[model samples]
Target chain A: MKRWLPSSLLSGMLFVLWLLLNQSLDPAHLLLGTVLAVVAPLLARTLMQPIGYPRLAKPIILIRLLGMALVEIVHSAITVSRLILFPKPDGMNSQFIKIPLDLRNPYGLALLSCLINSTPGTVWVEILPNRHELVLHVFDLHSEQWWVDTIKTRYEKPIIDIFHEEVHKENPP
Target chain B: MNEMETIPLWAAALLVSLLILGGSIILIGALGLMRLPDFYQRIHGPAITVTLGAGCVLIASMLYFTVLQSRLVLHELLITVFVLMTAPIVSMLIIRAAVYRDLRARKRDSGVESGGIYRFPEQE
Candidate 1:
Protein backbone atom coordinates (compact mmCIF):
# COMPACT_ATOMS: atom_id res chain seq x y z
CA MET A 1 0.00 0.00 0.00
CA LYS A 2 2.80 2.38 0.90
CA ARG A 3 4.68 1.58 -2.28
CA TRP A 4 1.63 2.03 -4.45
CA LEU A 5 0.33 5.12 -2.70
CA PRO A 6 3.44 7.26 -2.62
CA SER A 7 1.23 10.27 -1.82
CA SER A 8 -1.82 8.95 -0.14
CA LEU A 9 -2.85 12.39 1.07
CA LEU A 10 -2.87 13.72 -2.48
CA SER A 11 -4.83 10.72 -3.69
CA GLY A 12 -7.32 11.06 -0.88
CA MET A 13 -7.72 14.71 -1.68
CA LEU A 14 -8.35 13.87 -5.32
CA PHE A 15 -11.00 11.36 -4.31
CA VAL A 16 -12.76 13.82 -2.05
CA LEU A 17 -12.45 16.56 -4.64
CA TRP A 18 -13.96 14.36 -7.31
CA LEU A 19 -16.94 13.50 -5.14
CA LEU A 20 -17.40 17.08 -4.02
CA LEU A 21 -17.31 18.38 -7.58
CA ASN A 22 -19.76 15.81 -8.77
CA GLN A 23 -21.89 16.29 -5.63
CA SER A 24 -22.84 12.61 -5.66
CA LEU A 25 -22.15 9.40 -3.75
CA ASP A 26 -23.65 7.15 -6.33
CA PRO A 27 -21.84 3.84 -6.80
CA ALA A 28 -20.64 4.87 -10.24
CA HIS A 29 -19.08 8.13 -9.08
CA LEU A 30 -17.51 6.43 -6.09
CA LEU A 31 -16.01 3.68 -8.21
CA LEU A 32 -14.66 6.11 -10.78
CA GLY A 33 -13.23 8.43 -8.14
CA THR A 34 -11.65 5.50 -6.32
CA VAL A 35 -10.04 4.20 -9.48
CA LEU A 36 -8.70 7.65 -10.40
CA ALA A 37 -7.49 8.31 -6.86
CA VAL A 38 -5.60 5.02 -6.68
CA VAL A 39 -4.03 5.29 -10.11
CA ALA A 40 -3.32 9.01 -10.44
CA PRO A 41 -0.66 9.15 -7.75
CA LEU A 42 1.08 6.07 -9.02
CA LEU A 43 1.23 7.33 -12.58
CA ALA A 44 2.28 10.82 -11.48
CA ARG A 45 4.89 9.53 -9.05
CA THR A 46 7.71 9.95 -11.51
CA LEU A 47 7.08 13.67 -11.86
CA MET A 48 6.60 14.29 -8.13
CA GLN A 49 9.49 14.97 -5.79
CA PRO A 50 9.31 12.75 -2.75
CA ILE A 51 8.84 15.24 0.06
CA GLY A 52 8.34 12.74 2.81
CA TYR A 53 4.88 12.99 4.29
CA PRO A 54 4.12 16.64 4.89
CA ARG A 55 1.97 16.13 7.97
CA LEU A 56 1.23 18.11 11.10
CA ALA A 57 3.70 16.56 13.51
CA LYS A 58 3.07 19.09 16.29
CA PRO A 59 -0.52 20.15 16.41
CA ILE A 60 0.05 22.94 18.89
CA ILE A 61 2.92 24.38 16.93
CA LEU A 62 0.95 24.05 13.71
CA ILE A 63 -2.01 25.87 15.20
CA ARG A 64 0.12 28.64 16.63
CA LEU A 65 1.99 28.99 13.36
CA LEU A 66 -1.24 29.18 11.38
CA GLY A 67 -2.64 31.79 13.76
CA MET A 68 0.49 33.87 13.37
CA ALA A 69 0.35 33.55 9.60
CA LEU A 70 -3.30 34.57 9.45
CA VAL A 71 -2.72 37.61 11.63
CA GLU A 72 0.40 38.66 9.78
CA ILE A 73 -1.28 38.29 6.41
CA VAL A 74 -4.20 40.47 7.46
CA HIS A 75 -1.98 43.11 9.06
CA SER A 76 0.29 43.24 6.07
CA ALA A 77 -2.64 43.54 3.72
CA ILE A 78 -4.01 46.47 5.71
CA THR A 79 -0.59 48.13 5.81
CA VAL A 80 -0.08 47.76 2.07
CA SER A 81 -3.57 48.99 1.38
CA ARG A 82 -2.95 52.06 3.50
CA LEU A 83 0.32 52.69 1.73
CA ILE A 84 -1.41 52.35 -1.59
CA LEU A 85 -4.27 54.67 -0.66
CA PHE A 86 -2.17 57.38 0.97
CA PRO A 87 0.91 57.52 -1.21
CA LYS A 88 1.33 59.40 -4.45
CA PRO A 89 1.79 57.55 -7.68
CA ASP A 90 5.42 56.64 -6.96
CA GLY A 91 5.93 57.17 -3.24
CA MET A 92 6.92 53.64 -2.31
CA ASN A 93 10.47 52.28 -2.26
CA SER A 94 11.10 48.91 -3.90
CA GLN A 95 14.39 47.04 -4.20
CA PHE A 96 15.81 43.55 -4.06
CA ILE A 97 18.08 42.26 -1.30
CA LYS A 98 19.80 38.90 -1.21
CA ILE A 99 19.61 36.92 2.02
CA PRO A 100 21.55 33.78 2.88
CA LEU A 101 19.30 30.73 3.19
CA ASP A 102 19.83 28.30 6.10
CA LEU A 103 17.00 25.99 5.13
CA ARG A 104 18.10 23.87 2.17
CA ASN A 105 15.27 21.35 1.95
CA PRO A 106 13.22 21.66 -1.24
CA TYR A 107 9.87 21.61 0.55
CA GLY A 108 11.03 24.17 3.09
CA LEU A 109 12.27 26.46 0.35
CA ALA A 110 8.95 26.08 -1.40
CA LEU A 111 7.08 26.94 1.79
CA LEU A 112 9.31 29.94 2.41
CA SER A 113 8.51 31.31 -1.00
CA CYS A 114 4.82 30.69 -0.42
CA LEU A 115 4.81 32.53 2.90
CA ILE A 116 6.82 35.44 1.53
CA ASN A 117 4.48 35.87 -1.40
CA SER A 118 1.41 35.46 0.76
CA THR A 119 2.55 38.37 2.88
CA PRO A 120 2.03 41.77 1.36
CA GLY A 121 4.94 44.13 0.54
CA THR A 122 7.45 41.34 -0.09
CA VAL A 123 8.10 39.15 -3.11
CA TRP A 124 10.59 36.37 -3.75
CA VAL A 125 12.75 37.67 -6.56
CA GLU A 126 15.20 34.84 -7.22
CA ILE A 127 17.56 32.28 -5.78
CA LEU A 128 20.78 30.94 -7.14
CA PRO A 129 20.94 27.22 -7.81
CA ASN A 130 24.56 26.85 -6.71
CA ARG A 131 24.46 29.35 -3.85
CA HIS A 132 22.03 29.43 -0.92
CA GLU A 133 21.28 33.09 -1.62
CA LEU A 134 17.63 34.17 -1.86
CA VAL A 135 16.78 37.54 -3.35
CA LEU A 136 13.53 39.24 -2.32
CA HIS A 137 11.92 42.58 -3.12
CA VAL A 138 10.17 44.65 -0.50
CA PHE A 139 7.83 47.61 -0.93
CA ASP A 140 9.19 49.46 2.08
CA LEU A 141 13.00 49.30 2.50
CA HIS A 142 13.52 50.69 5.98
CA SER A 143 16.46 48.42 6.76
CA GLU A 144 17.80 45.54 4.66
CA GLN A 145 19.32 43.72 7.64
CA TRP A 146 16.01 43.90 9.50
CA TRP A 147 14.19 42.07 6.70
CA VAL A 148 16.93 39.44 6.54
CA ASP A 149 16.85 38.80 10.29
CA THR A 150 13.06 38.75 10.50
CA ILE A 151 12.75 36.37 7.57
CA LYS A 152 15.46 34.02 8.81
CA THR A 153 14.22 33.83 12.37
CA ARG A 154 10.45 34.14 12.04
CA TYR A 155 9.76 32.23 8.82
CA GLU A 156 12.81 30.16 7.89
CA LYS A 157 13.51 28.49 11.23
CA PRO A 158 10.00 27.09 11.71
CA ILE A 159 9.81 25.96 8.10
CA ILE A 160 13.23 24.37 8.31
CA ASP A 161 12.24 22.59 11.48
CA ILE A 162 8.98 21.39 9.95
CA PHE A 163 10.41 20.02 6.70
CA HIS A 164 13.92 19.17 7.91
CA GLU A 165 12.41 16.72 10.38
CA GLU A 166 11.53 14.59 7.37
CA VAL A 167 15.05 14.88 6.03
CA HIS A 168 16.46 14.08 9.44
CA LYS A 169 14.28 11.02 9.76
CA GLU A 170 15.02 9.84 6.21
CA ASN A 171 18.80 10.12 6.52
CA PRO A 172 19.68 9.72 10.18
CA PRO A 173 23.01 11.32 11.02
CA MET B 1 -31.94 34.18 -2.36
CA ASN B 2 -34.72 32.27 -0.64
CA GLU B 3 -32.19 30.86 1.80
CA MET B 4 -31.92 34.41 3.16
CA GLU B 5 -34.99 33.92 5.33
CA THR B 6 -34.05 30.36 6.27
CA ILE B 7 -30.69 31.51 7.62
CA PRO B 8 -30.83 32.87 11.18
CA LEU B 9 -30.69 36.63 11.58
CA TRP B 10 -27.27 36.69 13.26
CA ALA B 11 -25.83 34.21 10.80
CA ALA B 12 -27.17 36.17 7.88
CA ALA B 13 -25.76 39.39 9.28
CA LEU B 14 -22.38 37.78 9.90
CA LEU B 15 -22.31 36.31 6.43
CA VAL B 16 -23.09 39.62 4.80
CA SER B 17 -20.39 41.38 6.84
CA LEU B 18 -17.78 38.79 6.02
CA LEU B 19 -18.62 38.95 2.37
CA ILE B 20 -18.44 42.73 2.49
CA LEU B 21 -15.07 42.61 4.18
CA GLY B 22 -13.74 40.26 1.56
CA GLY B 23 -15.08 42.33 -1.31
CA SER B 24 -13.73 45.54 0.17
CA ILE B 25 -10.31 44.04 0.64
CA ILE B 26 -10.29 42.95 -2.97
CA LEU B 27 -11.47 46.39 -4.04
CA ILE B 28 -8.70 48.07 -2.06
CA GLY B 29 -6.23 45.75 -3.71
CA ALA B 30 -7.53 46.77 -7.09
CA LEU B 31 -7.23 50.39 -6.07
CA GLY B 32 -3.61 49.71 -5.11
CA LEU B 33 -2.91 48.11 -8.44
CA MET B 34 -4.12 51.23 -10.18
CA ARG B 35 -2.20 53.60 -7.90
CA LEU B 36 1.11 51.80 -7.21
CA PRO B 37 4.18 52.76 -9.16
CA ASP B 38 5.80 49.80 -10.88
CA PHE B 39 4.86 46.31 -12.00
CA TYR B 40 6.47 44.78 -8.91
CA GLN B 41 4.75 47.11 -6.47
CA ARG B 42 1.44 46.69 -8.22
CA ILE B 43 1.64 42.91 -8.07
CA HIS B 44 1.42 42.95 -4.27
CA GLY B 45 -2.09 44.42 -4.47
CA PRO B 46 -3.71 41.47 -6.17
CA ALA B 47 -1.48 38.75 -4.77
CA ILE B 48 -1.98 39.36 -1.07
CA THR B 49 -5.45 40.87 -1.15
CA VAL B 50 -6.90 38.08 -3.24
CA THR B 51 -5.67 35.50 -0.74
CA LEU B 52 -7.25 37.15 2.27
CA GLY B 53 -10.28 38.32 0.37
CA ALA B 54 -10.99 34.88 -0.99
CA GLY B 55 -10.28 33.42 2.42
CA CYS B 56 -12.87 35.63 4.09
CA VAL B 57 -15.38 34.94 1.37
CA LEU B 58 -14.78 31.21 1.61
CA ILE B 59 -15.27 31.26 5.36
CA ALA B 60 -18.51 33.12 4.89
CA SER B 61 -19.61 30.65 2.29
CA MET B 62 -18.78 27.71 4.53
CA LEU B 63 -20.72 29.23 7.38
CA TYR B 64 -23.62 29.87 5.03
CA PHE B 65 -23.79 26.39 3.55
CA THR B 66 -23.44 24.77 6.95
CA VAL B 67 -26.35 26.81 8.25
CA LEU B 68 -28.53 26.27 5.21
CA GLN B 69 -28.09 22.53 4.82
CA SER B 70 -27.60 21.84 8.59
CA ARG B 71 -24.56 19.76 7.74
CA LEU B 72 -20.85 20.57 7.55
CA VAL B 73 -20.39 21.69 3.96
CA LEU B 74 -16.70 22.06 3.22
CA HIS B 75 -16.10 22.22 -0.47
CA GLU B 76 -15.10 25.77 0.37
CA LEU B 77 -12.05 24.44 2.21
CA LEU B 78 -10.77 22.82 -0.96
CA ILE B 79 -10.95 26.12 -2.84
CA THR B 80 -9.31 27.99 0.04
CA VAL B 81 -6.47 25.51 0.22
CA PHE B 82 -5.97 25.61 -3.51
CA VAL B 83 -5.83 29.41 -3.58
CA LEU B 84 -3.41 29.56 -0.64
CA MET B 85 -1.13 27.03 -2.28
CA THR B 86 -1.09 28.55 -5.73
CA ALA B 87 -1.14 32.31 -4.96
CA PRO B 88 2.41 32.36 -3.62
CA ILE B 89 3.83 30.24 -6.42
CA VAL B 90 2.23 32.58 -8.92
CA SER B 91 3.62 35.64 -7.11
CA MET B 92 7.11 34.19 -7.06
CA LEU B 93 6.98 33.48 -10.77
CA ILE B 94 5.72 36.96 -11.58
CA ILE B 95 8.35 38.66 -9.41
CA ARG B 96 11.16 36.50 -10.77
CA ALA B 97 10.13 37.17 -14.34
CA ALA B 98 9.73 40.89 -13.67
CA VAL B 99 13.14 41.11 -12.01
CA TYR B 100 14.78 39.22 -14.87
CA ARG B 101 13.18 41.51 -17.41
CA ASP B 102 14.10 44.58 -15.40
CA LEU B 103 17.70 43.44 -15.16
CA ARG B 104 17.90 42.72 -18.83
CA ALA B 105 16.34 46.02 -19.80
CA ARG B 106 18.36 48.04 -17.31
CA LYS B 107 21.63 46.37 -18.23
CA ARG B 108 21.47 46.36 -21.97
CA ASP B 109 25.00 47.73 -21.90
CA SER B 110 27.04 45.00 -20.12
CA GLY B 111 26.44 42.36 -22.81
CA VAL B 112 24.00 40.19 -20.78
CA GLU B 113 26.01 39.73 -17.58
CA SER B 114 23.65 39.63 -14.58
CA GLY B 115 25.04 41.92 -11.88
CA GLY B 116 28.67 41.25 -12.99
CA ILE B 117 28.07 37.52 -12.46
CA TYR B 118 27.51 35.35 -15.49
CA ARG B 119 24.86 32.69 -14.99
CA PHE B 120 24.78 29.85 -17.45
CA PRO B 121 21.40 29.55 -19.11
CA GLU B 122 19.35 26.52 -18.07
CA GLN B 123 20.11 23.47 -20.20
CA GLU B 124 16.57 22.27 -19.79
Candidate 2:
Protein backbone atom coordinates (compact mmCIF):
# COMPACT_ATOMS: atom_id res chain seq x y z
CA MET A 1 0.00 0.00 0.00
CA LYS A 2 2.85 2.38 0.89
CA ARG A 3 4.64 1.56 -2.36
CA TRP A 4 1.48 2.08 -4.42
CA LEU A 5 0.30 5.26 -2.69
CA PRO A 6 3.60 6.98 -2.05
CA SER A 7 2.16 10.44 -1.45
CA SER A 8 -0.69 10.41 1.03
CA LEU A 9 -1.17 14.17 0.99
CA LEU A 10 -1.31 14.31 -2.79
CA SER A 11 -3.79 11.43 -3.00
CA GLY A 12 -6.02 12.98 -0.34
CA MET A 13 -6.02 16.33 -2.14
CA LEU A 14 -6.88 14.57 -5.39
CA PHE A 15 -9.79 12.84 -3.71
CA VAL A 16 -11.08 16.11 -2.24
CA LEU A 17 -10.76 17.85 -5.61
CA TRP A 18 -12.74 15.00 -7.16
CA LEU A 19 -15.55 15.48 -4.65
CA LEU A 20 -15.57 19.25 -5.04
CA LEU A 21 -15.87 18.99 -8.80
CA ASN A 22 -18.59 16.33 -8.66
CA GLN A 23 -20.51 18.25 -5.94
CA SER A 24 -22.92 15.43 -5.20
CA LEU A 25 -23.26 12.91 -2.38
CA ASP A 26 -24.54 10.30 -4.76
CA PRO A 27 -22.86 6.93 -4.29
CA ALA A 28 -22.19 6.52 -8.01
CA HIS A 29 -20.14 9.71 -8.24
CA LEU A 30 -18.32 8.92 -5.00
CA LEU A 31 -17.35 5.46 -6.24
CA LEU A 32 -16.30 6.81 -9.66
CA GLY A 33 -14.19 9.60 -8.22
CA THR A 34 -12.56 7.29 -5.72
CA VAL A 35 -11.55 4.95 -8.52
CA LEU A 36 -10.11 7.85 -10.48
CA ALA A 37 -8.27 9.34 -7.49
CA VAL A 38 -6.44 6.11 -6.87
CA VAL A 39 -5.97 4.83 -10.41
CA ALA A 40 -4.79 8.05 -12.05
CA PRO A 41 -1.68 8.37 -9.95
CA LEU A 42 -1.08 4.66 -10.16
CA LEU A 43 -1.03 4.96 -13.94
CA ALA A 44 1.18 8.03 -13.70
CA ARG A 45 3.65 6.36 -11.30
CA THR A 46 5.63 4.71 -14.07
CA LEU A 47 6.37 7.90 -16.02
CA MET A 48 9.30 9.47 -14.16
CA GLN A 49 9.52 7.17 -11.15
CA PRO A 50 9.43 8.73 -7.72
CA ILE A 51 12.47 10.52 -6.31
CA GLY A 52 13.45 10.79 -2.66
CA TYR A 53 11.07 12.92 -0.62
CA PRO A 54 12.46 15.97 1.14
CA ARG A 55 11.84 16.18 4.90
CA LEU A 56 9.92 19.49 4.58
CA ALA A 57 11.47 20.59 7.87
CA LYS A 58 10.41 24.22 7.89
CA PRO A 59 6.67 24.92 8.14
CA ILE A 60 7.17 28.14 10.14
CA ILE A 61 9.60 29.43 7.55
CA LEU A 62 7.12 28.61 4.77
CA ILE A 63 4.39 30.59 6.56
CA ARG A 64 6.77 33.53 6.88
CA LEU A 65 7.61 33.21 3.20
CA LEU A 66 3.91 33.38 2.31
CA GLY A 67 3.48 36.53 4.40
CA MET A 68 6.50 38.13 2.77
CA ALA A 69 5.24 37.18 -0.70
CA LEU A 70 1.85 38.78 -0.04
CA VAL A 71 3.53 41.99 1.06
CA GLU A 72 5.83 41.97 -1.96
CA ILE A 73 2.87 41.51 -4.29
CA VAL A 74 1.15 44.66 -3.00
CA HIS A 75 4.35 46.70 -3.06
CA SER A 76 5.30 45.50 -6.53
CA ALA A 77 1.78 46.16 -7.83
CA ILE A 78 1.97 49.80 -6.75
CA THR A 79 5.44 50.19 -8.27
CA VAL A 80 4.45 48.60 -11.57
CA SER A 81 1.22 50.62 -11.78
CA ARG A 82 3.12 53.86 -11.33
CA LEU A 83 5.60 52.85 -14.00
CA ILE A 84 2.79 51.89 -16.33
CA LEU A 85 0.72 55.06 -15.81
CA PHE A 86 3.57 57.57 -15.70
CA PRO A 87 6.40 56.76 -18.05
CA LYS A 88 9.77 57.26 -16.35
CA PRO A 89 12.10 59.73 -18.08
CA ASP A 90 14.49 56.91 -18.89
CA GLY A 91 11.65 54.55 -19.78
CA MET A 92 11.95 50.96 -18.46
CA ASN A 93 15.58 50.25 -17.79
CA SER A 94 15.38 46.52 -18.59
CA GLN A 95 18.68 44.71 -18.26
CA PHE A 96 19.51 41.05 -17.80
CA ILE A 97 21.45 40.57 -14.55
CA LYS A 98 23.08 37.23 -13.96
CA ILE A 99 23.28 36.03 -10.32
CA PRO A 100 25.47 33.07 -9.60
CA LEU A 101 23.58 30.33 -7.73
CA ASP A 102 24.84 27.49 -5.55
CA LEU A 103 21.49 25.72 -5.22
CA ARG A 104 21.66 22.92 -7.81
CA ASN A 105 18.52 20.98 -6.94
CA PRO A 106 15.91 21.02 -9.72
CA TYR A 107 13.03 21.73 -7.32
CA GLY A 108 14.83 24.68 -5.70
CA LEU A 109 15.52 26.29 -9.07
CA ALA A 110 11.84 25.83 -10.00
CA LEU A 111 10.65 27.54 -6.80
CA LEU A 112 13.07 30.45 -7.39
CA SER A 113 11.67 30.99 -10.89
CA CYS A 114 8.07 30.90 -9.65
CA LEU A 115 8.81 33.47 -6.92
CA ILE A 116 10.68 35.78 -9.31
CA ASN A 117 8.06 35.56 -12.07
CA SER A 118 5.09 35.96 -9.74
CA THR A 119 6.45 39.28 -8.50
CA PRO A 120 5.18 42.13 -10.70
CA GLY A 121 8.40 44.08 -11.31
CA THR A 122 10.63 41.11 -12.07
CA VAL A 123 10.76 38.24 -14.53
CA TRP A 124 13.00 35.16 -14.58
CA VAL A 125 14.58 35.65 -17.98
CA GLU A 126 16.96 32.71 -18.23
CA ILE A 127 19.27 30.29 -16.49
CA LEU A 128 22.75 29.59 -17.91
CA PRO A 129 23.83 26.14 -16.69
CA ASN A 130 27.50 25.95 -17.60
CA ARG A 131 28.19 29.18 -15.71
CA HIS A 132 25.64 28.49 -12.89
CA GLU A 133 24.02 31.89 -13.36
CA LEU A 134 20.30 32.74 -13.34
CA VAL A 135 19.22 35.79 -15.34
CA LEU A 136 16.41 38.06 -14.19
CA HIS A 137 14.85 41.23 -15.61
CA VAL A 138 13.74 43.98 -13.23
CA PHE A 139 11.28 46.68 -14.26
CA ASP A 140 12.92 49.24 -11.98
CA LEU A 141 16.57 49.01 -10.99
CA HIS A 142 18.03 51.80 -8.83
CA SER A 143 20.99 49.63 -8.00
CA GLU A 144 21.83 46.21 -9.50
CA GLN A 145 23.44 45.19 -6.22
CA TRP A 146 20.23 45.81 -4.30
CA TRP A 147 18.22 43.45 -6.57
CA VAL A 148 20.88 40.77 -6.20
CA ASP A 149 20.86 41.10 -2.42
CA THR A 150 17.07 40.98 -2.20
CA ILE A 151 16.87 37.86 -4.36
CA LYS A 152 19.51 36.07 -2.35
CA THR A 153 18.29 37.10 1.08
CA ARG A 154 14.52 36.98 0.62
CA TYR A 155 13.83 34.18 -1.88
CA GLU A 156 16.92 32.04 -2.42
CA LYS A 157 17.82 31.31 1.20
CA PRO A 158 14.36 30.02 2.12
CA ILE A 159 14.40 27.77 -0.93
CA ILE A 160 17.82 26.46 -0.02
CA ASP A 161 16.58 25.67 3.48
CA ILE A 162 13.56 23.79 2.16
CA PHE A 163 15.47 21.91 -0.52
CA HIS A 164 18.53 21.46 1.73
CA GLU A 165 21.33 22.22 -0.72
CA GLU A 166 24.71 23.92 -0.43
CA VAL A 167 24.75 27.10 -2.53
CA HIS A 168 27.87 29.12 -3.20
CA LYS A 169 27.91 32.64 -1.79
CA GLU A 170 28.99 35.15 -4.44
CA ASN A 171 28.65 38.89 -4.99
CA PRO A 172 27.20 40.02 -8.33
CA PRO A 173 29.56 41.95 -10.60
CA MET B 1 -46.45 56.01 -10.29
CA ASN B 2 -46.67 53.05 -7.93
CA GLU B 3 -43.58 52.45 -5.79
CA MET B 4 -43.00 49.01 -7.20
CA GLU B 5 -39.97 47.14 -5.92
CA THR B 6 -37.17 46.95 -8.46
CA ILE B 7 -33.44 46.36 -8.15
CA PRO B 8 -32.19 49.63 -6.66
CA LEU B 9 -31.45 51.85 -9.68
CA TRP B 10 -27.85 52.29 -8.54
CA ALA B 11 -27.32 48.54 -8.10
CA ALA B 12 -28.77 47.80 -11.50
CA ALA B 13 -26.56 50.45 -13.08
CA LEU B 14 -23.47 49.11 -11.36
CA LEU B 15 -24.13 45.54 -12.47
CA VAL B 16 -24.73 46.57 -16.04
CA SER B 17 -21.54 48.64 -16.13
CA LEU B 18 -19.44 45.86 -14.65
CA LEU B 19 -20.83 43.27 -17.07
CA ILE B 20 -20.13 45.52 -20.03
CA LEU B 21 -16.63 46.33 -18.84
CA GLY B 22 -15.79 42.67 -18.32
CA GLY B 23 -17.16 41.63 -21.72
CA SER B 24 -15.42 44.47 -23.54
CA ILE B 25 -12.05 43.80 -21.92
CA ILE B 26 -12.27 40.13 -22.85
CA LEU B 27 -13.13 41.06 -26.43
CA ILE B 28 -10.20 43.48 -26.58
CA GLY B 29 -7.87 40.79 -25.32
CA ALA B 30 -9.03 38.44 -28.07
CA LEU B 31 -8.52 41.20 -30.61
CA GLY B 32 -5.02 41.78 -29.34
CA LEU B 33 -4.20 38.16 -30.04
CA MET B 34 -4.72 38.81 -33.74
CA ARG B 35 -3.35 42.37 -33.93
CA LEU B 36 -0.05 41.88 -32.03
CA PRO B 37 2.95 41.37 -34.33
CA ASP B 38 4.88 38.64 -32.52
CA PHE B 39 4.17 35.65 -30.28
CA TYR B 40 5.75 37.11 -27.10
CA GLN B 41 3.87 40.43 -27.30
CA ARG B 42 0.65 38.64 -28.17
CA ILE B 43 1.10 36.40 -25.13
CA HIS B 44 1.10 39.35 -22.71
CA GLY B 45 -2.22 40.58 -24.12
CA PRO B 46 -4.28 37.69 -22.73
CA ALA B 47 -2.94 38.27 -19.20
CA ILE B 48 -5.24 41.29 -19.05
CA THR B 49 -8.28 39.19 -19.85
CA VAL B 50 -7.30 36.33 -17.58
CA THR B 51 -6.45 38.58 -14.64
CA LEU B 52 -8.63 41.71 -14.82
CA GLY B 53 -11.43 40.65 -17.15
CA ALA B 54 -12.09 37.40 -15.34
CA GLY B 55 -11.80 39.22 -12.04
CA CYS B 56 -14.46 41.75 -13.07
CA VAL B 57 -16.84 39.07 -14.27
CA LEU B 58 -16.35 36.94 -11.16
CA ILE B 59 -16.93 39.88 -8.86
CA ALA B 60 -20.07 40.73 -10.79
CA SER B 61 -21.23 37.13 -10.51
CA MET B 62 -20.61 37.12 -6.77
CA LEU B 63 -22.41 40.42 -6.31
CA TYR B 64 -25.43 39.56 -8.45
CA PHE B 65 -25.89 36.14 -6.88
CA THR B 66 -25.45 37.39 -3.31
CA VAL B 67 -28.23 39.90 -3.80
CA LEU B 68 -30.55 37.32 -5.34
CA GLN B 69 -29.85 34.50 -2.86
CA SER B 70 -29.91 36.80 0.21
CA ARG B 71 -26.66 35.07 1.21
CA LEU B 72 -23.27 34.74 -0.50
CA VAL B 73 -23.14 31.97 -3.10
CA LEU B 74 -19.47 31.39 -3.76
CA HIS B 75 -19.33 28.51 -6.23
CA GLU B 76 -17.93 30.99 -8.73
CA LEU B 77 -14.77 31.13 -6.63
CA LEU B 78 -13.78 27.67 -7.87
CA ILE B 79 -13.74 28.98 -11.42
CA THR B 80 -11.63 31.97 -10.37
CA VAL B 81 -9.14 29.84 -8.46
CA PHE B 82 -8.85 27.25 -11.23
CA VAL B 83 -8.30 29.93 -13.85
CA LEU B 84 -5.77 31.81 -11.77
CA MET B 85 -3.67 28.72 -11.04
CA THR B 86 -3.92 27.10 -14.46
CA ALA B 87 -3.53 30.10 -16.77
CA PRO B 88 0.17 30.58 -15.98
CA ILE B 89 0.90 26.91 -16.53
CA VAL B 90 -0.94 26.94 -19.86
CA SER B 91 0.84 30.12 -20.94
CA MET B 92 4.26 28.74 -20.01
CA LEU B 93 3.69 25.45 -21.84
CA ILE B 94 2.56 27.23 -25.01
CA ILE B 95 5.53 29.60 -24.93
CA ARG B 96 7.97 26.75 -24.31
CA ALA B 97 6.52 24.72 -27.20
CA ALA B 98 6.59 27.69 -29.58
CA VAL B 99 10.20 28.41 -28.64
CA TYR B 100 11.14 24.75 -29.13
CA ARG B 101 9.49 24.57 -32.55
CA ASP B 102 11.20 27.80 -33.64
CA LEU B 103 14.57 26.49 -32.50
CA ARG B 104 14.08 23.21 -34.37
CA ALA B 105 13.13 25.07 -37.50
CA ARG B 106 16.13 27.37 -37.05
CA LYS B 107 18.50 24.42 -36.63
CA ARG B 108 17.22 22.70 -39.78
CA ASP B 109 17.39 26.00 -41.62
CA SER B 110 20.93 26.99 -40.57
CA GLY B 111 22.28 24.20 -38.29
CA VAL B 112 23.66 26.64 -35.70
CA GLU B 113 23.01 27.88 -32.12
CA SER B 114 23.79 31.41 -33.36
CA GLY B 115 20.14 32.39 -32.72
CA GLY B 116 20.53 32.05 -28.88
CA ILE B 117 21.06 29.55 -26.11
CA TYR B 118 17.87 27.53 -25.69
CA ARG B 119 17.61 26.00 -22.20
CA PHE B 120 15.54 22.98 -23.10
CA PRO B 121 15.44 22.29 -26.82
CA GLU B 122 13.20 19.62 -28.34
CA GLN B 123 16.14 17.25 -28.54
CA GLU B 124 16.60 17.46 -24.78
Best by TM-score: 1
Q: What does TM-score give for chain A of every model?
A: 0.83, 0.81
Best by lDDT: 1
Residue-wise C-alpha lDDT for candidate 1, range A1-173, written one tens digit per residue: 78977777788889999988787789999999999999988887767555554553454665566678778888988888778778856466666677888887776677778778888888886686566688777887889899989998888877766664577666655
**What total of clashing residue pairs does each candidate reach?**
0, 0
Which residue pairs of candidate 1 clash?
none
> Against the unseen true structure, what C-alpha lDDT does each candidate score?
0.76, 0.63
lDDT of 1: 0.76
Q: For residues B2-118, could you state the per-residue lDDT of candidate 1 as single tens digits?
A: 766788899988998999989988898888888775676788889657777888889999999899988878888778888998988888887667656755765553522344332
RMSD of each: 5.0, 7.8
> Among all windows of ten consecutive residues in candidate 2 chain B, which has the lowest summed lDDT?
B111-120
C-alpha lDDT of residue B56 in model 1: 87
Angstrom error at residue A62, model 1: 4.2
Q: How well does candidate 2 reproduce the true complex, by DockQ? A: 0.13
**Deviation of model 2 at B79, angstroms:** 4.1
Off by over 4 Å in 1: A25-31, A49-63, A88-90, A169-173, B108-124
lDDT tens digits by residue: candidate 2, B58-82: 9889777766656656667778767
